[model samples]
Target: MRQHGLLTLGAGLCAAAALGLAAPHPALAAPDSCSYTSPTHQPTLTHGDTGAAVKQAQCLSNMWGGEPPKLPLDGVFDSVMLKKIKWIQGCHGLPQNGVIKDRTWQVLYHPALDCYDPYPV
Candidate 1:
Protein backbone atom coordinates (compact mmCIF):
# COMPACT_ATOMS: atom_id res chain seq x y z
CA MET A 1 0.00 0.00 0.00
CA ARG A 2 2.86 2.43 0.89
CA GLN A 3 4.69 1.69 -2.37
CA HIS A 4 1.47 2.16 -4.33
CA GLY A 5 0.87 5.56 -2.64
CA LEU A 6 4.43 6.72 -3.50
CA LEU A 7 3.90 5.73 -7.15
CA THR A 8 0.62 7.67 -7.26
CA LEU A 9 2.28 10.77 -5.74
CA GLY A 10 5.14 10.61 -8.26
CA ALA A 11 2.68 10.31 -11.13
CA GLY A 12 0.68 13.25 -9.84
CA LEU A 13 3.85 15.39 -9.65
CA CYS A 14 4.84 14.38 -13.14
CA ALA A 15 1.39 15.22 -14.44
CA ALA A 16 1.49 18.58 -12.70
CA ALA A 17 4.86 19.34 -14.30
CA ALA A 18 3.60 18.32 -17.73
CA LEU A 19 0.52 20.44 -17.31
CA GLY A 20 2.72 23.47 -16.41
CA LEU A 21 1.17 23.83 -12.98
CA ALA A 22 4.55 24.80 -11.59
CA ALA A 23 4.74 28.14 -13.40
CA PRO A 24 2.72 30.43 -15.60
CA HIS A 25 2.47 29.37 -19.23
CA PRO A 26 3.30 31.78 -22.08
CA ALA A 27 -0.38 31.95 -23.01
CA LEU A 28 -1.30 32.56 -19.39
CA ALA A 29 0.95 35.61 -19.25
CA ALA A 30 -0.61 39.01 -19.79
CA PRO A 31 -0.91 39.97 -23.45
CA ASP A 32 1.06 42.85 -25.03
CA SER A 33 -2.19 44.52 -26.04
CA CYS A 34 -0.96 47.73 -24.46
CA SER A 35 1.49 48.33 -27.31
CA TYR A 36 -0.49 50.84 -29.32
CA THR A 37 -0.18 50.42 -33.09
CA SER A 38 -1.82 53.46 -34.72
CA PRO A 39 -4.66 55.83 -34.15
CA THR A 40 -7.79 54.69 -35.96
CA HIS A 41 -9.66 57.88 -35.08
CA GLN A 42 -8.48 61.02 -33.36
CA PRO A 43 -9.44 60.14 -29.81
CA THR A 44 -8.69 63.16 -27.66
CA LEU A 45 -6.38 61.94 -24.89
CA THR A 46 -6.03 64.13 -21.83
CA HIS A 47 -3.92 63.77 -18.70
CA GLY A 48 -6.48 61.76 -16.73
CA ASP A 49 -7.17 59.04 -19.30
CA THR A 50 -5.92 55.43 -19.05
CA GLY A 51 -5.93 52.64 -21.68
CA ALA A 52 -4.14 51.07 -24.65
CA ALA A 53 -4.56 54.24 -26.67
CA VAL A 54 -2.68 56.21 -24.06
CA LYS A 55 0.07 53.63 -24.18
CA GLN A 56 0.19 53.97 -27.96
CA ALA A 57 0.50 57.71 -27.61
CA GLN A 58 3.35 57.23 -25.20
CA CYS A 59 5.08 54.94 -27.66
CA LEU A 60 4.68 57.52 -30.40
CA SER A 61 5.90 60.27 -28.11
CA ASN A 62 9.04 58.26 -27.44
CA MET A 63 9.76 58.28 -31.15
CA TRP A 64 10.45 62.00 -30.84
CA GLY A 65 13.83 60.99 -29.43
CA GLY A 66 16.39 62.79 -27.20
CA GLU A 67 16.11 64.75 -23.90
CA PRO A 68 13.76 62.95 -21.53
CA PRO A 69 14.11 59.21 -21.42
CA LYS A 70 11.44 57.09 -23.02
CA LEU A 71 8.25 56.72 -21.05
CA PRO A 72 7.15 53.31 -19.85
CA LEU A 73 4.81 51.28 -22.07
CA ASP A 74 2.18 51.15 -19.35
CA GLY A 75 -1.29 52.42 -20.29
CA VAL A 76 -1.62 55.35 -17.93
CA PHE A 77 -1.70 59.07 -18.82
CA ASP A 78 -0.08 60.45 -15.72
CA SER A 79 1.69 63.80 -15.25
CA VAL A 80 4.92 62.42 -16.73
CA MET A 81 3.08 61.53 -19.91
CA LEU A 82 1.36 64.89 -19.82
CA LYS A 83 4.69 66.65 -19.66
CA LYS A 84 6.01 64.63 -22.55
CA ILE A 85 2.94 65.44 -24.61
CA LYS A 86 3.33 69.09 -23.81
CA TRP A 87 6.96 68.98 -24.86
CA ILE A 88 6.08 67.29 -28.12
CA GLN A 89 3.35 69.81 -28.76
CA GLY A 90 5.78 72.59 -28.08
CA CYS A 91 8.36 71.05 -30.38
CA HIS A 92 5.77 70.83 -33.14
CA GLY A 93 4.64 74.46 -32.70
CA LEU A 94 1.26 73.43 -31.27
CA PRO A 95 -0.32 74.83 -28.15
CA GLN A 96 1.63 74.15 -24.97
CA ASN A 97 -1.40 72.54 -23.39
CA GLY A 98 -0.96 68.81 -22.75
CA VAL A 99 -4.16 67.92 -24.58
CA ILE A 100 -3.83 65.32 -27.37
CA LYS A 101 -6.27 66.59 -29.97
CA ASP A 102 -6.53 66.01 -33.74
CA ARG A 103 -3.54 68.24 -34.51
CA THR A 104 -1.59 66.62 -31.72
CA TRP A 105 -2.24 63.19 -33.20
CA GLN A 106 -1.15 64.46 -36.58
CA VAL A 107 2.09 65.82 -35.17
CA LEU A 108 2.64 62.59 -33.26
CA TYR A 109 2.11 60.40 -36.31
CA HIS A 110 3.93 62.71 -38.71
CA PRO A 111 6.49 64.62 -36.66
CA ALA A 112 7.37 67.65 -38.74
CA LEU A 113 9.93 68.99 -36.29
CA ASP A 114 11.20 71.48 -38.87
CA CYS A 115 7.92 73.04 -40.04
CA TYR A 116 6.91 74.80 -36.84
CA ASP A 117 9.36 76.71 -34.65
CA PRO A 118 10.56 74.52 -31.79
CA TYR A 119 8.65 75.26 -28.62
CA PRO A 120 10.75 76.94 -25.95
CA VAL A 121 11.90 74.39 -23.39
Candidate 2:
Protein backbone atom coordinates (compact mmCIF):
# COMPACT_ATOMS: atom_id res chain seq x y z
CA MET A 1 0.00 0.00 0.00
CA ARG A 2 2.78 2.48 0.91
CA GLN A 3 4.72 1.73 -2.31
CA HIS A 4 1.62 2.20 -4.43
CA GLY A 5 0.91 5.61 -2.81
CA LEU A 6 4.50 6.77 -3.39
CA LEU A 7 4.37 5.69 -7.01
CA THR A 8 1.12 7.54 -7.61
CA LEU A 9 2.47 10.69 -5.97
CA GLY A 10 5.65 10.57 -8.05
CA ALA A 11 3.67 10.09 -11.26
CA GLY A 12 1.45 13.02 -10.42
CA LEU A 13 4.44 15.25 -9.76
CA CYS A 14 6.05 14.23 -13.03
CA ALA A 15 2.86 14.96 -14.94
CA ALA A 16 2.60 18.37 -13.29
CA ALA A 17 6.18 19.15 -14.16
CA ALA A 18 5.66 18.11 -17.77
CA LEU A 19 2.58 20.27 -18.04
CA GLY A 20 4.37 23.24 -16.56
CA LEU A 21 7.19 22.87 -19.06
CA ALA A 22 4.86 22.46 -22.02
CA ALA A 23 2.51 25.33 -21.27
CA PRO A 24 3.52 28.98 -21.61
CA HIS A 25 2.99 31.34 -18.73
CA PRO A 26 0.29 33.98 -19.05
CA ALA A 27 2.83 36.77 -19.33
CA LEU A 28 4.71 34.94 -22.06
CA ALA A 29 1.59 34.12 -24.07
CA ALA A 30 0.51 36.27 -26.99
CA PRO A 31 -2.17 38.85 -26.36
CA ASP A 32 -5.73 38.07 -27.37
CA SER A 33 -5.79 41.15 -29.61
CA CYS A 34 -3.39 43.82 -30.78
CA SER A 35 -3.40 46.84 -33.05
CA TYR A 36 -0.41 47.50 -35.28
CA THR A 37 0.51 48.04 -38.90
CA SER A 38 3.48 47.73 -41.21
CA PRO A 39 5.03 50.57 -43.11
CA THR A 40 3.05 51.23 -46.25
CA HIS A 41 6.04 52.34 -48.18
CA GLN A 42 9.80 52.58 -47.97
CA PRO A 43 11.58 55.86 -47.55
CA THR A 44 13.04 57.30 -50.71
CA LEU A 45 16.81 56.95 -50.42
CA THR A 46 17.96 59.18 -53.21
CA HIS A 47 21.68 59.43 -53.90
CA GLY A 48 21.97 62.85 -52.25
CA ASP A 49 18.70 62.88 -50.33
CA THR A 50 19.63 60.05 -47.93
CA GLY A 51 16.12 59.08 -46.87
CA ALA A 52 17.40 56.21 -44.75
CA ALA A 53 19.66 58.55 -42.86
CA VAL A 54 16.88 61.00 -42.24
CA LYS A 55 14.50 58.29 -41.06
CA GLN A 56 17.10 56.84 -38.73
CA ALA A 57 17.80 60.25 -37.32
CA GLN A 58 14.12 60.88 -36.75
CA CYS A 59 13.64 57.54 -35.03
CA LEU A 60 16.59 58.13 -32.74
CA SER A 61 15.37 61.60 -31.95
CA ASN A 62 11.92 60.33 -31.11
CA MET A 63 13.36 57.56 -28.94
CA TRP A 64 15.66 59.88 -27.03
CA GLY A 65 13.18 62.76 -26.88
CA GLY A 66 15.67 65.29 -28.20
CA GLU A 67 17.34 66.59 -31.28
CA PRO A 68 19.43 64.03 -33.13
CA PRO A 69 22.96 64.66 -34.29
CA LYS A 70 23.03 67.05 -37.18
CA LEU A 71 24.09 64.57 -39.82
CA PRO A 72 23.79 65.15 -43.53
CA LEU A 73 21.04 63.23 -45.30
CA ASP A 74 23.30 62.29 -48.21
CA GLY A 75 24.09 58.61 -47.57
CA VAL A 76 27.05 59.60 -45.44
CA PHE A 77 25.67 57.54 -42.49
CA ASP A 78 26.52 59.12 -39.15
CA SER A 79 28.75 56.74 -37.17
CA VAL A 80 27.55 57.93 -33.77
CA MET A 81 23.89 57.84 -34.66
CA LEU A 82 24.46 54.58 -36.50
CA LYS A 83 25.71 53.03 -33.29
CA LYS A 84 22.56 54.15 -31.49
CA ILE A 85 20.46 52.80 -34.35
CA LYS A 86 22.25 49.49 -34.11
CA TRP A 87 21.42 49.37 -30.41
CA ILE A 88 17.79 50.00 -31.16
CA GLN A 89 17.84 47.33 -33.84
CA GLY A 90 19.42 44.87 -31.48
CA CYS A 91 16.77 45.52 -28.84
CA HIS A 92 14.03 45.00 -31.40
CA GLY A 93 15.64 41.90 -32.97
CA LEU A 94 16.41 43.69 -36.19
CA PRO A 95 19.36 43.20 -38.55
CA GLN A 96 21.39 45.82 -36.64
CA ASN A 97 22.79 47.23 -39.88
CA GLY A 98 22.37 50.75 -38.52
CA VAL A 99 20.63 51.55 -41.80
CA ILE A 100 16.87 51.78 -41.65
CA LYS A 101 15.51 48.73 -43.43
CA ASP A 102 11.83 48.00 -44.06
CA ARG A 103 11.55 45.82 -40.97
CA THR A 104 13.18 48.50 -38.89
CA TRP A 105 10.85 51.05 -40.37
CA GLN A 106 7.87 48.89 -39.52
CA VAL A 107 8.99 48.63 -35.94
CA LEU A 108 9.76 52.32 -35.75
CA TYR A 109 6.33 53.32 -37.01
CA HIS A 110 4.22 50.74 -35.17
CA PRO A 111 4.02 50.57 -31.41
CA ALA A 112 3.11 46.89 -31.37
CA LEU A 113 5.36 45.26 -33.91
CA ASP A 114 5.29 41.89 -32.25
CA CYS A 115 1.51 41.88 -32.04
CA TYR A 116 0.45 43.66 -35.19
CA ASP A 117 -3.12 43.26 -36.35
CA PRO A 118 -3.15 43.57 -40.13
CA TYR A 119 -6.96 43.81 -40.32
CA PRO A 120 -8.64 44.40 -37.02
CA VAL A 121 -12.23 43.29 -37.08
Top candidate on lDDT is 1
Residue 105's lDDT within candidate 1 is: 84
- What TM-score, computed on C-alpha atoms, does each candidate reach? 0.61, 0.38
Q: Candidate 2 — which residues are off by over 4 angstroms?
A: 1-39, 44-61, 64-76, 111-121
**Model 1: residues with Cα > 4 Å off, grouped in runs:** 1-38, 113-121
lDDT of 2 by residue, 24-69 (tens): 1123212222112123544533222445446443433243211132
**So what's the TM-score on candidate 2?**
0.38
Q: Please write out the lDDT profile of model 1 over residues 32-112, one tens digit for every residue.
A: 332465456558889889887887787676665433446787879998888778877776678989999888987776664
| Alpha-carbon RMSD, each predicted model | 18.2, 15.7
